[model samples]
Target: MITAENLTKRYGAKTAVDDVSFTVRPGQVTGFLGPNGAGKSTTMRMIVGLDRPTSGHTTVGGTDYRHLKAPLREVGVLLDAKAVHTGRSARSHLRAMAATHGIPARRVDEVIELTGLTSVAGKRAGKFSLGMGQRLGIASALLGDPHTLILDEPVNGLDPEGVRWVRQFVRYLAAEGRTVLLSSHLMSEMSQTADQVIVLGRGKVLADAPLSELVRSWTTSQVRVRSPRAAELADRIAGDGVTVTSAGAGLLDVAGLPADRIGDVAAAHGIPLHELTPTTGSLEEAYLALTGESVEYKTKEIA
Candidate 1:
C-alpha cells in the first residue's frame, strides 16, 4: 500500500503541493485527478522520491521510497513515457532497467510480451509511435513485478484497444492484491477503472472518497419529459429554483425538480404526458462540478 501524510512541496515562493494526504490500498485501483497546475505530478514525484517534499512524508509499504532497499521490487512507477534513451532499442531499454535491479532476462522478455511490445522489441525507442512508447514504458514498470504501481496518463496516446487493454491489465494486477495509483484526465475511463478517487485542486486535496460516493454527492439529477403540451407543461411546472428547457419538438429537459414532482404538476394541469425519465449525472459532470472553480485556465464561453 502507499500512503501520503500531509505531504507538501514548494519551489521558491510557490507551493506546488499543499498538505495533501491520501492512502492507496492494495487490491484496489485509486485514481488521482486534478486540473492543470494542480500538483498531481508533483505529488507523484514526491511519492517516488524523484522530488523531495518540503514537509510531511510519503511511504510505500511503511517505508519511504528513498529508504527502500530494493525500490524497484516494491514499487513500479511510469511518470513519463518519453524519459527514455532515444538511442536504445525497446529491448535494450528494458534490459538496462532490469540490470539495475538484477532482474532476470526472462522477466524482461515476459514484460515485453505482456505489454504487447514483443513485435517492436528490437526497434529503436526513437522510432516508436506514441502508443508504442507508452507500451514500452509500461513494460519497464512491470519488469520488476512490483507490488505497487503508479501510472500517470498511461492511456494518453493509446487507441481504444490499447486503452481497454490497460484497463483490464490494471484490474488484473489489483485483483492479485497489488496497489494501483492511476492519474489521468479521462474521467470516463477512470469511472470504469477506479474503485476510489482523490481529487486535487490548486495544490490542496479537494476530495478523497469512493468513486460511487463522489458521483452520488457531487452530481445533480435531472428529468427528461416528452409531451404533446410540452410548452404548456413547462410553463406550469417552472417555479422557484426550477428550470425547464425546450429540448426539441414535444420534449423538455427539466432540472431543479424531480420526475415525480414534474408528473404531479403535469397531471394537475391536465397535460397529456408521453414520457418522463430521470437521468443520473455522469462522472464528467461530477468532476466538472467539483473542480469548476479550481480550473487554473479559464476560457470565455461562446455565446
Candidate 2:
C-alpha cells in the first residue's frame, strides 16, 4: 500500500504540489487523475523519491522509498518509458536494471515473455516503436515482482489491442492482492480498470472515492424512454424536481424519476412503451465536471 500525508512540493517560488493526502490500498487499482499542471507527475515523483517533498511525506508499505532495503522488490515504478538508454537492447536494459538489485537473469526472461517482447527482446531500445518501449518499461517494473506498482500513462502510445492488454493486466495484478496506482488520461479505460480514484486539481486533492460514487456525485442519471405516447408520458411524469425533455420522434430523456416508477406510471396510464433504459453518467462526464475548472491549458471551441 502507498500512503501520503499532506505531501507538498515547491520548485523555487512556484508550488508544484500542494498539501495532498491519499491512500492507495492493496488488492485494488487506484486511478490517479487530473488535468495538465495539476501536480500529478510531481506527486508521483515524490512518492518514488525522485523529488524531495517540501513538507509532509509519502510512504510505500509504511516506509519511505529511499529507506526501503530493496526498493525494487517493495515497489515498482514506471514514470517514463522513454528514459532508457538508446544504445542498449531491450534485454540488456532489463538485465542491467535487474543486476542492480541482484535479480537473476531468469526473471528478466520471464518479464520479457510476460510483456510479449520476446520477438524484439534482442532489438536495440532506440529501434523499438512507442508501444514496444512501453512494454519494455512495464517489463522492467515487473522485473522484481514487487507488491506495489506505480504506472504513469502506461498506455500512452499503445494500439487498441495493447490498450486492452494493459487494462486486463493491471486488473489481474490488483486481484492478486497487490497495490496498483495508475495514472492516465484515458477515462474510459480507467473506469473499466480502477476500483477507486483519487483526483487532483492544481496540486490539491479535489476528490477521492470509488469510481461509482464519484460519477454519481458529479453527474446526474438519466432515463431514456421511447413510446408512441411520449408527450402524454412526459406530461404525466412532470412534477417538482422531475424533468422530461423530448428526444426526436418518440423518445424522451427523463430525470429525477426511477425507471420502475416510470414503467409503473406508463402501465397505469396504458401508455404503449417501446423502450425505458436508464443511463448513468459516464466516467468521462464525471471527470470533465470535476476537472473542468482545473484545466491549465484551455482550448477554445472551433466555430
Candidate 3:
C-alpha cells in the first residue's frame, strides 16, 4: 500500500505540488489522473524519493522509500522508460538492476519473458522501438517481484495489442493482492482497469473515489427511446428536472429518467415503443467535467 499525507513540493518560488493526501490500498488498482502541469509527475517523483517533499510525507508500505532495507523488493517503480543507458542491451539493463539488490540472473530472465521482450532481449536499448523500450522498463520494475507497483504512462507508445496486454497484466497484478498505482491519459483504458481513482488539478487533490461513484457524481444518466409516438412520449415525460430532445422522427434522447420508469410510463399510455436503452455516462465524460477548469493549456477554437 502507498500513503501520502499533505504532501507538498516547491521548485524555487513555484509550488509544483500542493498539500495533497490519498491512500492506495492493496488488492486494487488505483488510477492517477490530471491534465498537463497538474503536478502528477512531481507527486510520483516524491513518492519514489526522486524529489524531496517540501512538507508532509509519503510512504511505500509503512516506511519511506529511502528507508526500505531492500527497496526493489518492497516497491517497483517505472517513472521513465527512456531513462535507460543507450549503450546497454535490454537483457544487460535488467541484469544490472537485478545485480544491485542481489537479485538472481534467472529472475531477470523471468521478467524478460513475462514482459514479452524475449525476442528482443539481446537488442540494444537505444535501437529498440518505443513499445519495446516500455516493455524493458516494465521488466526492470518486475525484476524484484515487489509487492507494490507504480507505473507512469506504461502504455504511452504501445499498439492496440500491447495496450490490451498491459490492461490485463495490471489487473492480474492487482488481483494477486499487490498494490498498483497507475497513471494514464487514456480514460477508456483506465475505466476498464482501475477500481478507484485519485484526481489531481493544479497541484491539489480535486477528487478521489471509486470509478463508479466519480462517474455518477460528475455526469448525468441518459436513456434513449425510439417510438412511432415519440412526440407524445416526450410530452408525457416532460416535467421538472427532466429533459427530452428529439433525435429524428422516431427517436428521443431523455435525461433524468431511467429506462424502466420510461417503459412503465409508455406502457400506461399504451404507446408503441420500438427501443428503450439506458446510456450511462462514460469515464471520459466524467473526467472532462472534473478537470474542465483545471486544464492549464487550452487550445483556441478554429473558425
Candidate 4:
C-alpha cells in the first residue's frame, strides 16, 4: 500500500504541491488525475524520492521510499517512457536496469515477452515507434516484479490496440494484489481501468474517493423521459424545484430530482408516464466540472 499524508512542495513563491493526502490501496488501480500544472508530476516525484517534499510525508509499505531495503523490488516507477537511451536496444536497456539490483537475466527476457516487445527486443530503441518505446519502458518497470507501480501517462502515444493491451495489463497486475497508481489525462481510459481516484488542482487535493462514489456524489444525474403528452407532462414536472430541459418534440431531460419523485409528479397530475429510467453521469463530465477552473487549454494539431 502507498499513502501520502499532508504532502507539500514549493518552488520559490509558488506552491507546487499543497497539503495533499490520499491512500493508494493494494489489489486495485487508483487513478491520479489533475489538469496540466496541477502538481501531479511534482507529487509523484516526491513519492519516489526524486524530489523532496516541502512538508509532510509519503510512504510505501509504511516506510519512506529512501528507507526501503530494495526500492526496485518494492516499487517500480515509469515516469517518462522516452528516458531510455536511443543507441541501445530494448534488451540492453533492460539488462542495464536489472544489473543495478542483481536481478536475473531470465527476468529480463520474461518481461520482454510479457510486454509483447520480443519481436523488436533486439532492435535499437531509436528505431522503435512510440508504442514500442512505451512497451520497452513497461518491461523495464516489471523487471523487478515489484508490488507497487507508479506510471505517468502510460498510454500517451499508444495506438488503439496498444492502449487496450495496457489497460488489461494494469488491471491484471492489480488483481494479483499489487498496488497501481496511474496518472493520466485520459478520462475514458481512467474510467475503464481505475477503481478509485485522487484529483488535484493547483497543488491542492480537490477530491479523493471511490470512482463510483465520486461520480455519484459530485455530479447531477439527468434522466431523459419521452412521452406523447410532452406539454402537459413537462408543465406538471416543471417549476417543482427540479431543473428540466426540453428535448423539443416530445422528450424531456430531468435533473435535480429522483425518478420516484418524477413519477409522483406525473401521478398527481394524472399524466401518463411512458418512460422512466435511471441515468448515470459520466466520469468525464464529473472530472471536467471538478477541475474546470484549473484546466490549461492548448491548441495542437489533431492526431
Clashes of each: 0, 0, 0, 0
- Candidate 4 per-residue C-alpha lDDT over 52-87 given as tens digits, one digit per residue, 9 for 90 to 100: 998999999899999998888889898988899999
- Return the candidate ranking by TM-score, descending: 2, 3, 4, 1
Query: For each candidate, C-alpha RMSD in Å?
Result: 2.1, 0.8, 0.9, 2.8
For each candidate, the alpha-carbon lDDT, in order, equals 0.93, 0.95, 0.94, 0.89
Per-residue lDDT over 156-240 for candidate 1, one digit per residue giving the tens place of the 0 to 100 score: 8999999999999999999999999999999999999999899999999999999989988998778999999998898898899
Tell me the tens digit of each residue's lDDT in model 2 across 1-303. 999999999999988899999999999999999998999999999999999999999999999999999888888899999999999999999999998999999999999999999999999999999999999999988999999999999998899998999999999999999999999999999999999999999899999999999999999999999999999999999999998989989999999999999999999999999999999999999999999988888899899
Candidate 1 residue-wise lDDT at 116: 88
Clashing residue pairs found in predicted model 4: none
TM-score, per-candidate, Cα-based: 0.92, 0.98, 0.98, 0.92
What value does the lDDT take at residue 1 in candidate 4? Answer: 95
Give, for candidate 2, the lowest lDDT window spanning 10 residues.
69-78
Cα displacement (Å) at residue 139, model 1: 0.7
Error of 3 at 293 (Å): 0.9
Q: Which stretches in model 2 have alpha-carbon errors above 4 Å?
A: none
Q: Please give the lDDT score at residue 301 for candidate 4.
A: 57
Name model 1 segments beyond 4 Å from true: 235-242, 260-272
